[model samples]
Target: MIEAQGLTKKYGDRTAVDGISFTVHPGRVTGFLGPNGAGKSTTMRMLLGLDRPTAGSVMVNGRSYADFPAPLREVGALLEARALHPGRSARDHLRWMAASNGIPVRRVDEVLDLVGLPDVAGQRVGGFSLGMGQRLGIAVALLGDPPVVVLDEPVNGLDPEGIRWVRTLTRTLAAEGRTVFLSSHLMSEMALTADHLVVIGRGRVLADCSMPDFIAEHAASYVRLRSPQQAEVAALLRRNGLEVTDVDGELHIQGRDAASVGELVGRQGLLLHELTLVRSSLEDAFMTLTAASVEYSARQQTPAGALR
Candidate 1:
């Protein structure tokens, strides 16, 4: 498990990461989310010991990252910024890493094949495409079969198939009892992948909870009803202690499920044309939660006559 306690980082007059604390447990995929410039990168850097923190500390498996003699064999990570000798072949790169950490040379080919780059293992990465580069990076991370994996935007530049492959791979890793910490900007994919979430805004932890709980708390849900007797139906819902709003000859109801609302309206002899539940998606909830924390904001301009 990865444990961070009072993790903080400051740069001159700017404070990047505040006193944030969270735990990433084993046997599950924990997603890290935040708006741009929210100190996510800095926090991750501190976790990996790439940057010295101004205060507090982070530990992987109850030890600092540098304490492991064979670091790759204990913890694997793929950060957004990659440092590579572009002229080196993909296979050779992994071999060099494996050699430095006392990893077996034969493991190079295994990782190459695992990442779907066996056919082009000898090709220099300088000429590779963006997606290919990402695969090679992942191969480097998994070269040692570490127990902890930290991936930042692992699906970046990947095609649909590659994306699916990453999703499956992360889930498989977690199932194998490894700790997987994933950070991605793709909300739809994150929703499908991560079992837990750690959301940050302005260098502070906004939320840390299970996937379903985060959405249920931050995202709004309402039942929409269209009927000839909209007024009566709206009044009925209001009388039942439900919040009802009238819009465009339709009733929007809160505090009740569609099924219960339909049953109530039916008992009142109200003829219904439509009844549907609308729940905001992860992306929607994220936007609403981080609206004020955004450093840069743009006012959306709609086309003239776009709204009635």
Candidate 2:
């Protein structure tokens, strides 16, 4: 439902997003993931037509977002929680937005109820908590019932309950054949909430695939072995050209499967206390992929404290 063709954005001599392209399809949630300073926000801005791209363009439903007759009715976005007026009651704020967009006042209440903010509709936004503010923002986004919904860091400051609520809402929206494009740094949450993922690093597209395919391709499956004769097992595995590491008194063998390791250990008559397969986590896989692209990595040590 959304597509970007070589989208690029620059500031002075630096490129915030460098000629990256990806797509968001309907009937599923597409997660846009990247570490801090990875141009996720910039790309979203360009997609929403809030920021002009230095090159290329983005389209919503085969047309530029700017060309849509009624943008709110075609594309709904909560880029941040800037949709609310601090002094206006939630109901009044939504009412005004609806009125300005030619949307019915009834939609304001329907969306408020849908987002679980009906009870506090009369309360001023200034008195709302962060989660409440997020809910209010979501209500406005859904006010138009747009086919495409784009949310950036929707759960930035939400409590666990609020986070789950957002997750459920995202899945429900996708289930109903709506296009849900979300950007978040929470890999675990994305793993659960998104079926497809687009990973970006250093303002470039790092990986884009189904969630399961992404994990299987980037994450390694290793055979973990433990034996009291740790040194012998390590030597044996190394001689067979397997990369092995001894951590916390257990031997970790990479590049080999469980059956192969079991067969080798049995042939060598090595007494094995434990042996199992260990799958690399999605977080680890992501870190490994983007480790080199990290713009500013923390230092492990500092200059010798000026010789104290």
Candidate 3:
């Protein structure tokens, strides 16, 4: 297990990571998520002991990474894909890492095969494609057969096949009782990959919960109703103390259920053309949660008939 107690990092006048504390447990994939520049990478760096925290500390298996008896055997990480020497072959790279940890040279071949890079093991890493490089990086991480694994944007440049491979590989590792803490900005991917989530905004914890609970809490649900008397139906729904938005002649009602909406329309004797419930997606929930802390918000779309 990895525990971060009030881990805080400040660079000059700017605070990169606030006093955020969370635990990453074994046997599950915990996703570290936030918008770009939201201190995700900084926090991961502090967790790996690459950067000194201005306050607090992170412990891997009840000790700081450097304090662990065999750090590589206990904790393995892939902070960046191209971190390896460009001139070295993928096989040679893992071999050196194995040597550092006093691991058998055959263990290097096992990890290369584990990451499905056996054929390209002899090729220089500089000539590897982005997806191949990511695979090679993962191979290095698994070379030590660490109990705790941390990966940052492991699917950054993979094709669909490569992405699926990573998804299966991560799940398999977690299933074997390893601590998998992964970082990614892809909400859809996280929805599929993560069992738990640690969400951050402005270097602070926004949420730490199970994936299902996070969706149930943060993702909104609404009912869409359309009627010939659109404006009247909207006003009626609004009068019931529900928020309504007009979308293409449909009334999108918030904070109300479908059965309640149906009853309301029935009581009003309104002839409805359509009424459907829509659930906000995980992506939408993530965006809504991090919007204010988003370093770059996209340009707002103007309503129809606005001044051009």
Candidate 4:
């Protein structure tokens, strides 16, 4: 498990990270989310002991990251995949990392195979593609067989197959009782992968909760219906004290789920063509919750001859 209490960071007059506290438990994947310049990078740096916090502390298990004799064995991290010696072979890089922490030399090949880099293990990292570089970095992280893994944008630059591999790998790690802390900008992928969430805005922890709770609390849900008798259906629903919005030819309703709405319409003998429940996606909910916290906003202009 990882815990941060009143974690803070500062740069001259700028406060990059405010006092933030949260816990990342084991046996599940906890996703870190924030918009650009929300201080996510700084917070992660503090967690890994790459930067000193102006106040408070962040600890893996029960000790600071720097306190471990073999830090990689305690906390395997992939903060910056490209921060490596470009001229070194992938196998050489892993070998050096293994040697630094007294890890067995054979572990290098194990991690190389685990990250699907054994075929290109002898290739220089400078010539590796972005995706291959990411894989090599993952191999370095797993070389020590750490109990806790922290990955930021692990799927960045990965193709569909590579992305799926990462998803499965993270799940497998967590299932083995390791604490997995992941950060990614892809909301769709995060929704599918994360069991819990730790959302930040302006350096403060905005939310730390389960996936279902976060979505249910921040997202909107409504019943959508299309009927041959549109006018009667709208009137009936309105008279029944439900909020209804008509767009084009469809009626969007609140205050009831699809089944309840369907039952109500059926009891009134209304002929319905379509009825379904529409819930806002995780992206939608994130946008709604972090609207004000977004570090940048742009004014959109319609192009000439654009469709309405």
Candidate 5:
């Protein structure tokens, strides 16, 4: 497990990270979400002991990262997939990293196969494609078989198949009771992969909750209905104190779920054509929650003036 309490970071006069606290527990995948420059990378750096926090503390397992005798064995991180030497072969790269951390060379091959890079293990990293480079980075992170894994944009250059593989890999790691903290900007992928979410905006903790709870709290969920007696059904719903909106001849009922809406319509003897509970999507919820927190927003440009 990873525990961060009042973590903060500063660079000169600018504060990169505010005091934020969140816990990443074992047996689940926790997604770290934020827009660019929201201090996500800074927080990960501090967690790995790459950068010193201006205030507060972060612990991997039960102690600070620096306190571990074998840091790599306690936490495996893939912060930057291209942080390897271009001239070194994938095998050589892993071999050296394992040697430095006192890990067995055989473990290198195991991770290579685990990441499906065994065929290119002897190829130079400079000649590898973007996806291949990402695979190598993953292999490096898994080299120590650490219980805590922190990955930043693990699917950056991956194809659809590679993305699916990564999703399964992270889930499997969590299923094995390992603590998995994955950071990515892909909301659709996160929705599929993460069991929990930790959303940060402008260096502050915007939300920390389960996936379903986050969506329900931040975005609107409503029941959509279509009926031959559309006008009557809408009027009835409104009189019953439910807010209803008509769009393209369909009624969107708010403040009630599908079952309640259906029951109300049935009791009124209204024949319904369609009814669906439209739960807010993860992307929708994220946009709504972070609308005000976006650092760089593009303003709409007015077309050439025609009048006034």
Candidate 6:
């Protein structure tokens, strides 16, 4: 398990990571989510002992990363996919990594096969495509078979098949009781891959909760009602003090659940064709929560100053 308590980082005058605390427990995939420039990379660096935290502490398994005699055996991290020698073959790269970490050379071939890179193991990494490079990076991370895994944007250059493979692999690792901490900007993939989430915004902990709880708390849930008596139903709903919106002849009722809406419509004797509850998606919740935390936002301008 990974535990971070009051972790903070500073770069000269700027504070990149504020005092934040979150726990990544074993047997599940915990997604690390934030917009660009939200101090995610900085926190990861501190966790790996690559950067010193200005305050607080982080531990992989009851110990700091530097305290481990064999760090690779404790935690495997993939912060950069291209942080390898371009002239080296995929097999040679893993071989060197294993040698540095005192891992067996045979483990190199095992990781190659595990990442579906055995076919390209002998080829120079410079000749590999983006997806191939990502796979090689994952192979290095898995060389030690550590109980903890931390990956950042593992599917950045992957195709659909590669993405699916990564999703399954992370889930399998978590099922094996390993602590899997992943950071990604892909909300759709996170929704499928992560059981819990730790959302940070502007270097502060915005939320830390289970996936379902996060969505329920941040995203709006509404009941969509479609009726042959659309006008009557809408009027009745409005008269009842419920917030209703008409879109394409369907009445969308907010601030109430599907059961309440159905009961209200039934009491009015309105003929209903469809009544469904639509929960806001992860992306919707993310946007709503991080709107103020976004560092950069593009604003629309009047074209050529023609409008007053």
Name the top lDDT candidate: 5
lDDT by residue (tens digit), candidate 6, 1-308 = 99999999988899899999999999999999999999999999999999999999999889999999878888998999998889999998888888888999999999999999999999999988888989988987888999999999999899999999999999999999999999999999999999999999999999999999999999988899998899899999898899999998888899788998899889878899999999889999998889998999888786986775
Candidate 5 accuracy as lDDT: 0.94
Error of 2 at 297 (Å): 1.8
TM-score of each: 0.93, 0.89, 0.89, 0.97, 0.93, 0.93
152-175 in candidate 3: lDDT tens per residue?
Answer: 999989988888888988999999
| Clashes per candidate, residues 3 or more apart or on different chains | 0, 0, 0, 0, 0, 0
Candidate 1 local lDDT, 1-308, one digit each (tens): 99999999999989899999999999999999999999888988998889999999999999999899999999999995256888999989999999989999999999888889999999988888889999989998898899999999999999999999999999999999999999999999999999999999999999999988888889889999999888888788888999998888878888989999999999988899999999878888888889988988888998889976
For model 3, what is the error of residue 219's alpha carbon versus the real structure, in angstroms, after optimal superposition? 3.4
Decoy 2 TM-score against native: 0.89
Could you tell me the lDDT of residue 15 within candidate 1? Answer: 88
- How big is the positional error of residue 172 in model 5, measured in Å on the Cα after superposition? 0.9
In model 5, which runs have C-alpha deviations exceeding 4 angstroms? 267-269, 300-308
Per-residue error (Å), model 3, residue 268: 7.3
Task: In angstroms, give how far residue 181 of model 4 lies from its true place.
Answer: 0.3
Question: Which residue runs does candidate 4 get wrong by more than 4 Å?
Answer: 306-308
Better of 4 and 5 by TM-score: 4
Write model 4 residue lDDT over 105-208, tens digit each, in one string. 99999998888888999998999999998898888778889999999999999999999999999999999999999999999999999999999998888899
Worst 10 residues of 2 by lDDT: 299-308
| Model 4, TM vs. native | 0.97
**Residue 292 of candidate 4: its Cα lDDT?**
94
- Summing lDDT over every window of 10 consecutive residues in candidate 3, give the lowest-scoring window: 65-74
> What C-alpha lDDT values do all the predictions have?
0.92, 0.89, 0.89, 0.93, 0.94, 0.93
Over 132-247, each residue of candidate 2 has an lDDT whose tens digit, in order, gives 88888888888889999999989977889889999999999999999999988888888889999898998999999998888888888788888888898889989999999888
- Best TM-score goes to which candidate? 4
